[model samples]
Target: MPRIVSAFLCAAFIALGVTACAEPAHQKHAPQDPPDYKGVPTDMTPPSMLTPSAKPQ
Candidate 1:
């Protein structure tokens, strides 16, 4: 039983090592400036497009 447990642990560790080594290297994305929002519109919908919801009696 002890040997079986040890074998399973060793297999699991080897599997983990193999998977770790198979992954792609970490990539560094180029730094980018955030988009300017100084002139953007804040209101998505105007008051003219609003409608009252019908209520059940």
Candidate 2:
């Protein structure tokens, strides 16, 4: 009976050790979009057209 109990304990200890030493499962994360930023004007216009040209000196 003691031999059987010791053998069972040894087997349990080995199983627990193997599981504890194993690597954890990989976790995946969803890609996140950056914050919506409004910087430049939406309309594409040339600076020269927006402002009148200075008279040549």
Candidate 2 residue pairs in backbone clash: none
Q: Write the per-residue lDDT of candidate 2 for residues 1-57, one digit (tens) a residue.
A: 999999999999999999999987875876665678547468788776797867998
Provide the lDDT at 24 for model 1. Answer: 65
Listed in order, each prediction's TM-score against the native is 0.41, 0.45
Model 1's TM-score against the true structure: 0.41
Local accuracy of candidate 1 as per-residue lDDT tens digits, 1-57: 999999999999999999988966775797665687467677789777888678899
Error of 1 at 48 (Å): 74
* Alpha-carbon lDDT of model 1: 0.85
Q: What is the lDDT of candidate 2?
A: 0.85
Deviating ranges (above 4 Å) for candidate 1: 24-57
* Model 1 RMSD vs true structure: 10.9
**Residue 26, model 1: Cα distance from true site in angstroms:** 12
